[model samples]
Target: MLLETGSVVAVEPDGLWVETIQRSTCGSCAAQKGCGQSLLAKLTGHTSYLWVSLAGRSADDYHIGDEIQLGVPEEVVANGSLFVYFLPLLTLLAATVAAHYGIGREGVTALAAIAGLLAGGALVRWRAYTTRHDSRLQPVLVDDRQVVQLVG
Candidate 1:
């Protein structure tokens, strides 16, 4: 499980809307100017928001501005990254190879690769929609009682 602490921005019936600030160690890094992470951090800004499931705890237990710990399964991130990235590349390669050898046309092969990439993207979108509500994919409250901070 990967854990992060975020401040509750809003309380929902079944979950909490948490806001986390993205911090980078760019100031301490030697390659601050050259690192891709540094560039991304600059471009993406510092704030991120996510919905965290309550994990059977009552919403009444939390209030706005309360800091809480949330966890996401490591395998979920790894598997999701693989499925999202590799599927399109594999499809594109397969289509390009088949078109190159079977049809023996350079123009047709390029078009086939483009078509395959689009098909793969469509599949990814469909799968994401289907699994949007899957519990295994959601971040869960790590501890119900361990409030990091409470604002009265």
Candidate 2:
């Protein structure tokens, strides 16, 4: 199980609302100088992510402003992150390589590669966004006593 700490933002009769902060890798990236990728990321506000999850037990088990530990399975986190971060790049790489080798014309190969890259990137991003947006927190375990923390 994966564990994160979060504070209860809201408490309902049936469940508690927890906000989890999102982190970014841009600050750690070595190349940020006039880089299109970096600029795009900043423009899109991809630097941080916020999510909410349920305490998994009873809504009455927690209260507003209470800090609790939320648990998610490792596989779920891993798969979700990987699909978002890697799948599209992998698809583009595969496509570009396949096109380069399969086509004899340079113009065709370049166009195909660019098209594959854009399409693959879009597909991956859409999938990632959908998954993240639709994801609900399923509690593996909850600790009301623990302080609110973002575990991911």
User: What is residue 89's positional error in candidate 1, in angstroms?
Assistant: 0.9
Compose the digit string of candidate 2's lDDT tens values, residues 1-152: 88776667777654556654322444665666665656766688643223344434456666766666678888778876787667667777777788878886778777777787788779877865666545453444355444345568
Write out the backbone clash pairs for model 1. Answer: none
Candidate whose TM-score is highest: 1
Cα RMSD of all models vs. native, in order, equals 5.8, 7.6
Candidate 1 local lDDT, 23-92, one digit each (tens): 5445677887897666776798755688887766678999999978888899999999899999998889
Among all windows of 10 consecutive residues in model 2, the one with the lowest summed lDDT is 47-56
Reference-based lDDT, each prediction:
0.83, 0.62
Task: Point to the candidate with the largest lDDT.
Answer: 1
